[model samples]
Structures are given as structure tokens and as C-alpha cells.
Target: MKLIVRHAPLFALFVACGDPPSDTGKVVAPDSPSVIVDTPKLAANWPGYYSDTLPCLDCPGLDTQLWIRSDSTFIRLQKRIGLDSIPEGIIGRWHVVNGLMTVGYTGDKPEFYRYTADGLLTVDEMGVADNSKQDWTIEKFADEIGDAIPRMRLIGTFTYWADSQSFQPCGAEFSWPCTGGMDLGEEEGEPIVRFNNADLQKAYKQAVKRSGDPWTVEAICTLGMGPAAEGDGADEYIFIEQLPRTIERCP
Candidate 1:
């Protein structure tokens, strides 16, 4: 099978979650016996890239990559190994509160972080951490994020099914040697192409000629970073691919 995969640059792997206002509002001073001189400078050292392989319930582990910028903006990329699915990204605004950092997004849950001597560490909602915990630790890297995230490789056979009303493209998760019905509509942008009648007819005829059988299609796309934070819009797909194939049934 011919492979058509793309590995977006480290910066490209970033996805903007949603814009949440910066949490830089002034903190009301507490009335206490002791006086305070100045607020801490946590945000100064907070700009950089961090990554880790955390525990996963089903797959090998969750590969997480995060980028924190000086302007209080951040982006994150998450990938699930053993599952041939697309990598997901999030972009948002971030701020530090009493040494704890909060990354806010639109609909999903927020992520928290804390500063460390070596780098930034992922923490729970309460801003606490156990020194012995290393699973969620991400070390600071050079400005460029090259070679931080590992590329995902996928090889499989895809089948095309169509009718007067709809077109369905299905793909398998693992190699062709495995047996099971294919999963449909798992692609990130499959729905975007369904309305094109000309393309649909072309693909449908080719699949039918191949006896509606599966054909090996190798595709690779990157889930890279979108526009900078506070930019105008978000991309519907962080990753995309154009499969190069001469349709033929698998033997």
C-alpha cells in the first residue's frame, strides 16, 4: 500500500480549544495580621512547551503535548496510541493563580499546571501534587517543538459504499490481516465531502468495479497547531490527507 501521511511541524500540532478570558484580574488583598509586599511572578517562567505520556485506560498511554506562550495563551495536542484515530488539539487562554496555572477552554474541562525546577507539571484541580508522581511531568524544551511528539502510523484497507442519497467511506483500525466489519465515518472530514455529487459518483463506480471490496489506502495527516491564540477562527480539521489510489479490490 502507498502511504500518504503528513507530519505537521511541532508548532502545527497545536489546536486551539476555545477562547476563555484571561484570569489576570487583580486579587483582592486579604485582611490579615501579616502584610504582603508584592505578588509572585509565576507567569514569567510559565512560557514554554511541556509534554508527557500519562496513564491510559484502554490504550498504551495518552501522549500529551502542551505549548504555553508569553501572552497568556496556550495550546495542547492529545493522541491515543493503539487506536488509529486522529490526534486532537485545544487552544485557550491561561493564567497563574497562587502558583497554580489554569488553561480555560470552551466546552471541555479545563487543565491545570504548576511550575517546577525542571519544567511544568500537570496537577489536579486543587493545585496539589505528589513529588513521587512522574507520569504527568513535562520538561521544558527549546523554543522549537521539533521531535517532541511521536508520529502515528496507520495501514489498512478502506471500502466505499454509496447510493442515490448518501456516500459512506469506511476504514479499519488495524492492519488488513485482522478480521471484523469496518468502521464508517471515523474520518475527521468525511462528512465534508459527502455533498459533492460528482466526486461521490466517481468514487462509487470505482469501488463497485472492485466488487465493493476493500482496497489498501495508506494515509497520514498531522494534527498540527492552528492559528495563534486570539486569532479570528479555528480549523474544522487540524489534520488532512488526500489518498492517492487507483481503486481495486483487495485479493
Candidate 2:
């Protein structure tokens, strides 16, 4: 004998395929409008040299000179006022988010700052303004910070993509296309091809094998302005001078 089976209504199938009902028992559409967030824009006079003398416990004062470049990079020089030591230079990337600027160092905690009328004011990590009257402001000294590009140590992700190499600084949002050659003065006939050094390549390959492609690396490089990767304007590019080693992560 053949058994008869009952089937649900055709509308039930349609209900199963449609969007699930809301908590209020109403069908909610999946194609909802999204809220757009606007990115923070840097001030007109954001890029330049800023200087200030900060108080120090052991020394009379610390003469600090900060260079904020348009390429999302910064160079900070600090010298003890009465000490015989040379100025210490720190190189890293700077980024502004939610109206606060962050200076990210290679292996240190980020410093925060806020834009002021004349310069930048040091702030806490939570973006809170310094309450004491110790004068934590760095006054802008010059509008043009010179055209010379200095060789500095950088920690970033080195990637070879699309048949081209690039370096993304530890805290930067974008990557700069990289070139291999570096000037070796009058002694060398041609520039040293540092990027293709066997040790550097081996480290990069090992990094890729361990943590996938585009691994983090520490290197000494020079930053220069050049044509954008795919645009009509100019952008910052990196010229590798030395590849020190591969870093497990960005600090």
C-alpha cells in the first residue's frame, strides 16, 4: 500500500527564504542604509618644524625640535640643554584620528598631541589636554622644513606585490612604493642595491613562510617624494639603505 504524505503551504517556503523577522515580529530588510563617517583632516599648517624646551629632572631642560612632514612621517630631535651629548633623533610615522594626533615609535608607546593655533599641544593617550602650566606646547618654527630627505631607521611591513615592492610604516595608513638603490658616495661606481641583498631576501622569505607575505621588517631607509603609484599627483616613496632584520610585529 502507498502512504500519503502531507506538504506545507508554498508560502511557507517563501517565508523561509526571506529575511528573518525582527524581535517585534516584523520582517526587517537586509539592505539597510549605512552611516558614513568622515575622516579627520590635517590642519593647513600641520607640516613644519616645531620647537620647545621641555623640563627635565636631571638636566636643565630638553631642547626639542620636531619635524612633521606631509608624508605622514616625523623626526624628533631632543638634546639636553647643558649636557655634552648629541641630540637624539627619533623617526616614526604620525597619524591623526578622531581629532587627535598620534606619534607612533618603533618599539615605544605612542605620544598624543592636539593641534593648536600656533602649534601642537602635548596630550595624554586618552586625548585629554595637559592641565598643568608647564608649557607642553611645541611652537611651529618654520613653514617649510627643507627639501633634504634624511636616512632614518624605520619599522614597517615590507611587501612585494603586483611585481612592485612597497613599505608600510608601522602606524601609517598607506604604503610607499620602495626602490632598492642607495648612493655610496665617490668610492662606489654605482649605487648599492640593498634591497636585493641575500641576507635581506632570506629574512623576508623566512618571515613570509612563518607569518605569510608582507612581513614586518626593520630597516634604514630614506623617504623621498615621487609620483604616486596610480595617480596624477605625487606621493612619498622609500629608498632602502639597509635592511637590518625582520620583526615579529609592529611595536
Candidate 3:
């Protein structure tokens, strides 16, 4: 069983609304290092992102996306949902260790990924295999609050569904998954089951008017690896775009 870590415990509470007993004593580290991401690069031939999970179709859990910056700052997003909402918080970062591109949190003590030149992110660091970096997904955001939180204003009764900006998941093996490499939902060749970015926004508004239920949406943005299942390494590829999720409504 892979352990799926969230962006922030606070975000979880706002979205899901049930705290495990272990959440009570969780201490917030006083000082976390600032993650200065410089962007990652994708294969010149295939410079785009994909979604790992089909959003709206598979919108109930953690959403993610793949991001490749120009300077070779490879990234994968986790704990994201929706594609057109505001952001709440972010927990992941991009890093390079010993010539390997890795994704992790910005912390004094953080998990790191070592990417192969091909760009498939994996874990060989020798710890927490159960929570290996491979288990993570990436998502693109419309805004910092696209990781939207549960909140209710005192004087106003504006219902805001939990949602995020635009993003995608790096797919198991593909390139330019969505239309123009973003979640347009109208990708002529995309799976019919997956919903696109526009549909996500439509759903969010409908939910807000109806019941303020937060739904998560995402695509697995990945580097081009293949039609062959035999290859698995960072060097294989990278991705862009992200899915967002509106978990719950804040009263």
C-alpha cells in the first residue's frame, strides 16, 4: 500500500472534513526551506504535460500533473484537484541531486527524487519505499487558491466549491494527452470518460449552487516513455498540466 501524502493537513481538513486521531499532535516545523524552482525541461520533440488520473471521471482522490521547466527543473504535482479554481497551499518542490532531477517538499528534512535523463521520476534513495516518490502525482494550478480551502464569510453567503486552477497528470505512457497539452476535455483523441478543464469549472459552479461539494480533477503529466511497459525511469519523460479537486464545502 502506497502512502499518499497531502499538500497540507490543513487543506485536507478543509476539503475532506475528518481528521484522523494522529492529526492532533502533528507539529508544524518552525522553519522550512524556501524551494526556489527554476523550471524543468521536456524532450524537445515532446514538450508538454499529461494527466495521471482522468479527472471528473476519476475525481474522487488525490490529483496530479507533470511540469517540465526550461532549465531542466522537472516537477510533479500532488494533492491537487480541479483545473480552474483558486489555490490554497502547495507542498511539493523540484530539485536536482547528484545530476538527478527529483521532486519533493521544501524542508530541512525532505524526500527527494532522482530522475533519469529521460525524465521519469522514481525512487532509489533507499528509504520509505512504501511512500516512494513514484507514488506522487502532479497538478497545474490556476492560482495559489486554486488549491482552494473551505471557508465561509460572515456577512456574505457566497458558496465556493473546493476547486483548483488548470493542471494535468503525467499519464502512464503518452505525450500531449490533452488538447494543446492542457485539460480542454475536448481532446479529440482523449478517453471519453475523462472530463476536461471547462467541464470542471461547469461542475464547480453547479455544485456551489446546489451543495458546495468539492471535487478533484487532474491529469498525470509525464515525460514521454512509451508504448512499451518495459521502460520505467525519469529519463523516459516528464509532463505539464494538473487536475484539481474540490473535496468539500466549508460552512
In the order shown, the candidates' Cα RMSDs to the true structure are 23.2, 20.5, 26.4
lDDT of candidate 2 over 139-206, digit per residue (tens): 98787566645565677888764456777877666777776544445435644553443445555666
lDDT of 1 by residue, 1-251 (tens): 23344433332233346865344532334444443355444443777787777777788988777778776656666788777465554445777776688875534466677787667677887877756644667777745343322222223344444321211112211211111111225468555323233453455356555545555543233333333334686422222233435434221
Model 3 stretches with alpha carbons more than 4 Å out: 1-69, 75-93, 97-100, 105-198, 209-251
CA lDDT, every prediction?
0.50, 0.70, 0.35
> Per-residue alpha-carbon lDDT of model 3 for 151-214, expressed as tens digits?
1111111222343232222211112222212323555777533544555456556645454533
On a 0 to 1 TM-score scale, where does candidate 1 land against the true structure? Answer: 0.41
Candidate 2's displacement at residue 215, Å, is: 1.7
Name the lDDT value of residue 43 in candidate 1: 47
Query: Runs in model 1 with CA error above 4 Å?
Result: 1-44, 107-109, 130-134, 144-251
**Between candidates 1 and 3, which one is better according to lDDT?**
1
* Model 3 residue 170 distance off true place after TM-score fit, in angstroms: 13
1 or 3, greater by TM-score: 1
